[model samples]
Target: MVTDTRLYRKVTAQAWDRLDSRPARRTAWLGYDGSLPVIAGTVICLVVQKLPGGGGNKPVEAS
Candidate 1:
């Protein structure tokens, strides 16, 4: 739970926008374990890219 109002508001707004624009990408689940609600899931990488470098791969030396 977020205690800071400003942070909470910012996160809420971002969530609302994502929910509106990408509803299909959202995931939700509800379960009970001994009268207690439990939630577990995994989040995969959303974006992956290569880093900029020279042609040949080489290790840098420290002086």
Candidate 2:
């Protein structure tokens, strides 16, 4: 899970150019930017509410 910032920047620049050429994916990404947070929060709240022992105590697995 290591990143090289310089390579990432270079690839991202190229990807943006390529993505900008397409109307569909670009428009999808436009909505994703706004909706991701609300979606993620809802999922997290649902999981926590469903967790056993009333959600305060986190379970740690033995390594």
Candidate 3:
């Protein structure tokens, strides 16, 4: 059995070269701003939580 050392080294080098080549993505919190959309969502959730039934308002059906 003949082992190709040159090919093995080339493949190893290629793999290492791609280790940090991915485009870095900024985290959600880091890229997000204090905008109206965020504020609106928060307010909506708060309002929902403040509802009479504490959230779900489905009427119970009598059997």
- Evaluate model 3: give its TM-score: 0.14
Better of 1 and 2 by lDDT: 2
49 Cα displacement, candidate 1 (Å): 4.5
lDDT of 2 by residue, 1-63 (tens): 222343222111111121122233445466554333311111111112233333453544421
- RMSD values, in order shown: 16.7, 17.7, 26.0
TM-score of 1: 0.18
lDDT of 1 by residue, 1-63 (tens): 222242222111111122222223223323422333333333322211222342433444421
Write one digit per residue (lDDT tens) for candidate 3, span 1-63. Answer: 222343232111111121222224435447655542311111111111123334553433321
Worst 10 residues of 2 by lDDT: 38-47
Question: Candidate 1 overall Cα lDDT vs. reference?
Answer: 0.27
Q: Which candidate would rank higher by TM-score, 2 or 3? A: 2
Give each model's whole-structure lDDT. Answer: 0.27, 0.28, 0.28
Clashes of 1: 0
By TM-score, the candidates rank as: 1, 2, 3
lDDT of 1 at 22: 22
